[model samples]
Structures are given as C-alpha cells and as structure tokens.
Target: MTLLACVALISAAISFSSIAEPLTSAQQNQVRELIRDTLVNNPQILEEAVNAWEQRSTEQAGARLGKIIEQNKDALFNNAASPRIGAKNAKLTLVSFTDYNCPYCKQFDPRLEQIVKKYPDVAIVLKLLPFRGETSQSSAQYALTLWQQQPDRFLALHQRLMSKKGNHTKGSIVSALKSTGNDNLSIDKKTLDEVRSSLRLADLLGVQGTPATLIGDQMIPGAVSYDVLEQVVKAQLARTSS
Candidate 1:
C-alpha cells in the first residue's frame, strides 16, 4: 500500500479504537514506528499527504462558500439598493465587492465594461465596500447616494470614479460629481446604512480586499484578467443553461 493509504488506515484504526477499546501503549508505539519507517524510506509521502490534505481543505472551503452564496442570493443579486449594470434580468449574474480607491478595482473597471458589452445576458451587481479608509468611505457614500436619488446618473458617476487612479481627493470627487450632474449630492442616512450593509456582506463573504468577484459558486479575489472573467462567465452560463 502507498504510504498515504497506510496513514489513512492508521487514522481510521485509531478512530475505531477510540470508540471501542483504546489502543494499548505497545500498539500505539507500533503504529508510530510503522509511520516513521514509511516516511524515512519514502520521504515523498509527506509531500503527497500535504497536497491531499490541502486539496480536501480547499474543496471543503469552496463548499461552505457555495452554501453561503445560496443562502444570500437575494441580498447579493436582487437588492434594489445596490448599484448594478448590464442586463436587467440576466441569465448569469456577477457580484463584485469593490472599493473606489482600490487601484485594482480601477484596473478592473474597463474589463467589466467589456464583459457587459460582449455578453448581453449578463448582469453585474456592484457592492461598494469602502474599507480602504476615509477616501474610500466618501466615494462609496456618494455612489450609493447617487444610486438612490438618481439611478440614471449613477452609472456615469460610477465609471468616472472607477476611471480615476490613486487616492481620491475632495476636489476630485466633487469634480466627478459635477461632471455627472450630481455635484449637489450629499450622503444621507440611507446611503450610509447601505454602505454599512455592503461592508457587513463583504465580511460575511470573507472578502479581505477589494475587487472580489463572485461568479456562480466561486468568489474570485483580485483583479483577474478579462479572459479569465469571460471564461468564468461562460462556464456559469453553461451550467445554468444545462
């Protein structure tokens, strides 16, 4: 038997013994000696065992995440308070948790636009997570306010904000607001609550950083390439259609 298989059998035996009669001191020593000799002879078993454990852990994590997504589907996808783009009733939907001041989110902005243009049946729900600091918080509040008061102008403001690089200043934010004819916008209680809600959702999803994209059962972190984004979208579409 392979060393890994032997290790599994040893673990099973120990569990069985615990439920019945515990292993005697001599039997425990024998098991330990067997493992020691196996490892000494075939050191690669350690690497194989580690890889197997990691794969199982990853699969378990993915399954847990999928369950969470399923439970919160309405909040993630159909929230009227969230800013959204692309088809209204899409066959495939993507949820993105982003910070306006996050450079990676800025970098990923155009790629999202490209996806919208290319796939008419796809929709993107934008959750404004402003965990970067004050600048991020301000932008998120403003964006949410615009989405609440003037939905038509929200996309223009959103694209303009995402197009900007680095930290946003008061002046830069005001300029973008004015350009979108929303310079008079002010953060209201509702907007603040919405931003807070997004933050909580991000935390629940285990999103540690900005530019986290959710497609189907997977939550992909970082600014993935357009090709990768498209591939995931297509795969999701296929699954849904199947």
Candidate 2:
C-alpha cells in the first residue's frame, strides 16, 4: 500500500477505535507501532495536519462570528450615541470597539482612517470599551465628553490619544487635550454613563478585548489588514447594489 494510504488508514482506525470500540491487544500494538514508525520516519505530516486543523478552526470561528453579527445588527450598527466618522448617510458602516491603551487598536486607527478617506460613502463608528484599566476608563470618559461637547474635535482627540505611549492617566489625557488646543476640558458624569453603556453593549455582544470591528454582517476580532477591510466593504457594497 502507498505510504499516504497507510497513514490515512492508520489515522482513521485510531480515531474510530476510541469511540466505536476498544481495540484488541494485537490491534492496539499494530496501530501504535505503525503510527510511531510513520511519524518517526515522516514527522512533517503531523505538522501539516496540525496547520490544516488550525486553519479550519479559524475559518469556523470567523463564520460563526459572521452569523452573530447578523443576529445583532440593530444594536451593533444603530446606536446613535456612538462616535461616528465619515458620511452620516453612508451606505456602508463599520463599527469598532476599542480601548485607548490597546496597542492593536492604536495600530489599526490610522488604517481605519485611511479606509474612511478612501471610501467616502463609508461610516465608521468608534465604540469605547475601557477594559485595560483606570487609564483606559478615564480616557474613554474624556473621549465621550469630547464626543458630547466638541464632536468636531473628537477625531483629533482620538488620534492623539491612540498615538500616545506609556500609561494613560488623567494628567496624560489632559496633556493630550491641551496639546490639541482644548484648554478647558471637562469630562462629566453623563459622558461616563455613556461609556458604561458602551461597556454593557460590548458584554452583550461577547466582545472580550480591544479592536473588535464589525463591517456589515461580519465581526473581525482583531486588527485586520487593509486588504481585508477593503474587501469586506466592497463585498457589502456589491450586496447592497444587488
């Protein structure tokens, strides 16, 4: 028999042996020796199989999230209080949950902005989820405050904060705002409440970290590539046009 066929037979046999019935002593010894010899001679096959398995698992997870995004569309996309960028009446919308101190979110922020610039008809919503610490929470509160009081400058503030390194504290936040020329920054309780609401919504949506993005009926769990962002947007546009 061919080596590949032998490997497949041994794999199948071992897989079914546990569930269907226990193998006899001779059968167990034969299968074990076969697997051991095959692996010792050609160990790369195991690595190949493991890689394939991981790829399949990731694809399955993405598919599951796509369905979940569709199920929770209204809450995910229709929050009027969410900080928005780009055209308000845009046909394409991208919603992102991010923390101020999240490195991935910071890295993706510029890319997201570029996408917005490239796609004039795309609207991007920024949902603050401050799970990092007090720094993240306080920064989000200040962000929400800016969203409420000076929305025209919110994007600037967001860019500044994301660009900042080290710990995010009240002093850091205030310093960033002052650098942006907002001398009198006052973060209020209502803004804090809004941040809290965002956190609750994130929990309901099963978002456990920063940089979770939603485009159409798909949730991308991390900082996706520019190509990925473009593809998702184009696909949504095609679907809408169709």
Candidate 3:
C-alpha cells in the first residue's frame, strides 16, 4: 500500500479509537470494510498516492546525493590524478566512473565523444573503475599510466579500447596500445594506487557498476542515450550560467 493510503487508514482508525474506548472486533471489521469499500469505489486514489510517493522519494534521494556530491567536490571534479578530456577550462565538468570490460561503458563512449564535440565548454574527468575482473584492472592501470606519461595519446587509446567488441584480454590491450603508438607503456605502483583510489571513490558515491556519470549534483547510472546526456548537459549549463 502507498504511504498516503496507509496514513489515511491509520488516521481513520485513530479517529475511531478517540471517539470511544478501544474498538471491539466488530468495530475493527467495520473500519476494514470501510477502507475496502473506499478503495473499491475509488481505485484511482491508490494510483495517485503511489505517484506522489514516488515523486517525493526521488526528490529526497536527489537532495541527499546532492549533499554528498557537494561534500566531495574536489575529489570528484578536480583530482589531478584523474585523466580529463574536453575543454581545459570548462564551465561545467562531468566525472565518469567507467570500466573497460563493461559493455555498457563501450556503448556510452560514442555518445560521450559527441558530448565533448558538441559542448566545447564542458570537460569530462575519467575515473577508471576496474569492477569486472583482473583484465579490467590491468586495462585501467595501463590507461592511467598512459594518461600520466603521455596525455596527448591517451584519448586515442581510450577510444580504441572502448570501441572493442568484447572483454579485453592482455593481448587485446597491448594491440590497442600499439595501435595508438603507446606500446612501450608499463603500469607502475602509482597507477595501481590511482586505480584503487578510483574504486574507493566509486564506493563512496554508491556506484554499483560501470558508466556512472556525475553532472553537477546528479549521478546518472548506466549508459544513457545521447539525447538524455545532451539534455542534462544543457540543463546544468543553464543552471550554472544563471
């Protein structure tokens, strides 16, 4: 039952109790019958109540997450260790937690590229979360190390990796690295630490899987459509500009 409907029923019972002594079995049955009759005659009440509850719940969750994001702004948006793309001095920034082995993240890569192209003033910080397995971990470490050592070639390699059809193996990662002229790269201890930091940050932000994107205070989970991403970017731009 919806909270509103439950509240209404509880209030009716409370009123009945207050009007006299504790209700007998017969009076309790009467209250139950009354509620059933009301529901039967006005089923729309249930739907309306459910809709209201859902809206309120969504707003509450958003507000709670907004506060959390506000508290961790630096770690999320300005971490120097995180590799960034798009405008260097962007008016708005998006923090993306992604896994190379995740098919969804692969699906999201093209749309992300489009966003970068379409919105020159927006930046995206990439945090590689190796949630899938050892191959995922190795890939993330390689990407991070590459970004640190050779920033200019990182995007090309990233696009190559994300564009791959299935789970990345050691051979595939090396092949992609070679294709992007980053074949000599090696993962270091610092890169592994950065990968761990990314995982911890994802845990802090309640990320359950790949492709969790943070735009402003909202965290969009999974691979959203280009239109949805564009709409959010526009909305955030408007809000920040104002």
Candidate 4:
C-alpha cells in the first residue's frame, strides 16, 4: 500500500476504535494486519509518531510551567528576603536559583552580569540554593545570615564568593563576609531558618538543579547563551507591551 493509504488506514482504525461499538474478530484482524504491514514496510512512520508525541509533551510542560509562574508571581518576584541586584525600579526581573559550589552557576554569573550592565531597567535576584555539599551548605547559611542582617552587602559578598577559585568552606564564607565588610556577621537560628525557607521555595518552584533562571513566566535551566537570553527578554518585553 502507498504511504497515504497506510495513513488513511491507520486513521480509520483509530476512528473505529474510539467508537462505543465493538469490532468483530475479522475487523480486528484486518486492522491489526494493516498496522503490522504498515510498520514493516515503513518504520520511519513510527519514529515520526514518536517525535510528534514528544513535541506535544514538551509544549504541554511549558504551558503548565507558565501557569505555575503566574500563580507564584508574588513569591518569585517581590520577596524582601531574596537577595537582589541591579536597578531597584527595573521593568524586568530575573530570578536565579544557584548553588555556591556549582561551576555552572559561576559560569552563568558573567552572562547575568552582562545583561544587567546592558539593560538599565533590569533587576536580578540571586536565590541561594546549596545542593552541592557541606561546604556549599555552610556558605549558603552564612550568605543568608548576612542577607538578613545587612541586605545591602549581599551583592559584594556574592561577588567575593563567586570569584573564589577553590571549594567553599567555613573560612571561605568568613573571608568573603569580611571582604564585603560584613566581618561582624554571624549565622544564627533565624538566618538558618531563612536558608531552609529558600530551599523549600526552590522546591516549590520545581528547581531541581543549580543555575535555574526565571524571566517572566519562562524558566531557563543551565547555562544559556547570551543570544537565547536576550531573545527571551525581548520576547517578554514585546509580550508585556502588546
């Protein structure tokens, strides 16, 4: 049979199966034979079907994530506790969930900084999420504590921490704090609780890895190219203006 005939046969079989009435044994045999012969002659059709299914699934997932973002806009954007940088009255808000010890997070910093420098009306929030190891956890707790006591020094402390070459430790955290003029800061129960809360919030946002970025209703995971980032930002701006 021709490819077009094969497709029509498959469509007919599907349409018949969807109906309430049952098919006779001969009809079932015929449909099964058609399907088997189609596949044996043209295996590419199965691959095409699988690709279509995967594409649909991805689109559905993106839609669901968009809905989630709209529902949690307050928590994602306006939280006083989240460490923010860039223009305070910016039109665009970029929220990044990162681990101190994540190499990709370190790599992503420059791209993020580049955008911040280029866009005068853009604000970026760095959400501390430590899932690397003990050192990362300690550093995150210290950063959170510093944020609670002195939110102003967060950017400096973050820069210091990100610029460090080696693994983060208690000493590294202290040194970063001191370098950022937060030498007197100490991690207490309140700050520890804040760190835990941030982790819980990350979980709620479906953040499973380091360097997850949220721009408007879109989520970009991992290290992305500047072009992709710029495209998303422009698309969002266009959408809002429209």
Candidate 5:
C-alpha cells in the first residue's frame, strides 16, 4: 500500500482500539469523524478507489471501445482527411494503408483487384505508409510525387516497389519509375518537400504494417484473405441496406 494509505489505515486502527479500550462516547464519535475526513480527502485513498473500480470494469470498458468502433463504421473508412483513391463518393469504399517495402502488401494487391472487379460499387482507396523512415520515407516521397505527376502510372510504380528484391534503394525506385515509361521523374526540391508533408500524415494514422485495410471501423492488419475480407464487406453492405 501507498504510504498515505498505510497512514490512514493505521489512524483508523488506533481509533478502533480507542473504542474497545473504554474511551468516552464523545471521543469515539470524534475519532470516527477524523477517519471519515481523512478518507474523503486523502489522495492515496482516492487512487486505491479508482484502481479497484478499474479492476472490475476494465474488460467491460474494452468491449465498449470495440462496440464504439463497430457503430462508427463508415466514418472510419471514409476518412477523407487522409489520402484516398477510387470514386470520391463510392457506395462501398475499401481503404488500405500500405508501405512499399512490405512484401505482404504485394500479395494483398491481387486480392484487392478481385474485390474491385466483384463489386463495382466498391471503391479502393490507397494511402502511403512509408514507415521504415529515412530511406523508406524518401522512397515513398518519390512514389507519391510520381502519383501526383502521373496517376495513371501509379499501379505500375506500385508493382515495382513491391516486387523489387533487397532493401528499397533509391536506385531501385528510380529504375522502376524509369521502366514504367516515366524516365523524367526528376523530383525537384519543391516536389520532394511536398511529398514529405503528405507522408508524415500517413505515419500518424498508426500505420505499422502493409496491406492493412480499414473496412469501416474494423481495421484488418496484415495480408488478410479474400474470404475474410469478403465477409466483412458483406456485413457492412448489409448495414447500408438496412
């Protein structure tokens, strides 16, 4: 127990002892009042009380956070505040935050294609998560600028970054961009700075892994399977219909 709590307990114990030792009735009342006041105002007593409450309710509290996540639903997926793709007002939107150097992300790309083709109403939004920092950030910056310069070439550039073996070197990225018929991807000083700003925002979204999809509030991390993804989409679609 904390020192303050120990002191309070000892004070109460002495008061009880006084009661048993034939203290006057008035003195007993005064001792009880003293104990009451200490409990009411003591910081240690308050901390212990709070800890007890949390110990009982922590599991329920976690479950409630889960429910809040579920109910908010669409607001989480349609986070327009972050980078997005596909139809701006799509009925079914799948938001993915990914890092180029993550191999699992490449595996996820094909699954996304299946989802999009299966559901035309569904739109895919891609957000950059160049999370490895420094070199990763630089690679992501180059990729984003290229997307801005030529969005049509984004899919090809994405493939190169995902497929390239070894550490994601600037040389590899430049080579991939060149191979995609965008030989003049000269990231000028101003463009590099702009991409850096956007990348920072992606990092703040708690993006740790690639191929992470945010279907409504339910965020599925890693390379989730098509069947698993399809189940979530169906449930979300059901909510919309209702």
Candidate 6:
C-alpha cells in the first residue's frame, strides 16, 4: 500500500479504537507482536503499524462500540431509522448517534447535513444515542417521540433544537414545535413518560456520549470539520465502490 493508504488504514485503526472498548494490555501486546512478525522484514508497514498504534486515542477504544462499526456495516445501513430519501443501497452510509443536549452534536448536525447534500448517494441515518444523565434521557425521549409520532415535524424540531438559537429545554422545544403548526402535538408529561419507558436502541449501539457518528466502518466521536469528515467518508466510499 502507498503511504496514503497506510495513513488511511491507520485512521481506520484510530476510528476503531474510538468506537469499541479498548483491548486488554495482553491483547494489545499480542497485536504488537503480530505486527512485528508480519513486518519482520518490511520497514514501511512497520512504521505504519507504529504510527497506527501511537496515534490511537483513548476515545477510540469504546468498550462496546470500538469494533462494531466495521463489523456491522450492513446491519447499520439497513436498520431502522436509516434514511428513506438518500441512496438506500448506495455504497456509503453514515449513521449518526447523537444527543439533543450535546453541544458537539449541535455543531455536527449542520456539517452532517452538508455532507449528505454533497453526497446524495450516501444514505444517512440518525439514531438517538443518548449517554448523558437524566436530562439527556428525557431529551432523547422527546426527540424520538417526535421521530416516531410526528416524523416530519420531529426532524424539523431536531434541526432547530440542534441549532445555536434553538432551545433544548422542554418548554422551548414544545414552543418551537407549536410555532411550526404542530400546536396539537404534545410532548407533555405523558409523552415524556412514554419516551423514558423504552430505549433499547441506545443500549445496542453502546454509545457513551453525544455527537458520536458511524461513518462507514468508522465511529467518530465529538465535533469534526467537514474537511476531515470528507476525507474519511470519501476513502470509505472509494473502498466500497472498489
């Protein structure tokens, strides 16, 4: 592989580390030995290997999600909440797991929109992956209720809430929804009660924070610029298309 390819693979390693939980020291040591053996004579891959390891961040080693993004690509794209408008069977799918109250998620929301608009063939799925405290849970419930009960209205509410001027408080969200001619809608105690009752999807994804995204085989945590995201998405799209 070329140097760029090596970097890309190393990036993948970094991405993997962020999504799933970190490996045990023994396991990491074993992987190091394996690379040493494989690259016993190849200095380039050896360097690549070291860089991949050295560059890995703790965020990359999510306990339940680290290894999931790549291993479960097919299911993620075709799963519930996957987009119906974008490329359904396209070579690329970007799944975002975010919190309504997460400031980073707010920052990422627009960048995500631009990415999808730029690559219409890439299907984007937004899953409610809340990992904060009770407030986050309630926000997620409110959002998901909108998605399930008033999908069209829910997306609008979501975008607005994810904006700088948008409000995250319950009263604020309701008012925003009402202004959108959804006055008849209700996210009152009953609705909130219902949303809080069920949240199996979040558990399955093993999300620990807001603004976590699954781009192809990579799970990116925190806010990222379009430039960095574009490189990763484009590389995966190329790999899939190839």
TM-scores for the candidates? 0.89, 0.71, 0.92, 0.84, 0.60, 0.61
Better of 5 and 6 by lDDT: 5
Candidate 4 lDDT, tens digit per residue, 75-135? 7778777778888998889989888898888888888888888888888887788788888
Query: Which digits, one per residue and each the tens of the lDDT, describe model 3 over residues 42-97?
Result: 78878888898899999998898888788888888888878999999999999999
RMSD of 4: 3.1
Off by over 4 Å in 1: 8-30
Candidates by lDDT, descending order: 1, 3, 2, 4, 5, 6
N/CA/C clash count, model 3: 0
Clashes of each: 0, 0, 0, 0, 0, 11
Clashing pairs in 4: none
| RMSD per model, one decimal | 2.6, 4.3, 2.5, 3.1, 9.7, 12.0
Q: Which stretches of candidate 6 lie over 4 Å from their true place?
A: 1-75, 81-85, 132-135, 164-167, 187-206
In the predicted model 1, the residue pairs found to clash are: none
TM-score-superior candidate, 1 or 2: 1
TM-score winner between candidates 4 and 5: 4
What's the true lDDT of residue 18 in model 1? 83
Clashes of 1: 0
Q: Write the per-residue lDDT of candidate 6 for residues 1-242, one digit (tens) a residue.
A: 54565456656766887799887788678667755654565568767766877667544665346465445555565554432235656668777777676778888888888877788678677765545555566666666656666666666766766763433666766665576666566444544433332234344565566677777546677788989989988998888878
Error of 5 at 128 (Å): 1.0
Cα error, residue 71 of model 4, in Å, equals 2.2
lDDT at residue 181 of model 1 (Cα atoms): 87
Task: Show the lowest summed lDDT stretch of 10 residues, model 6.
Answer: 193-202
* Model 1 C-alpha lDDT per residue in residues 63-104, reported as the tens digit of each score: 999888888888899889999999988998899999889999
RMSD to native, candidate 2: 4.3
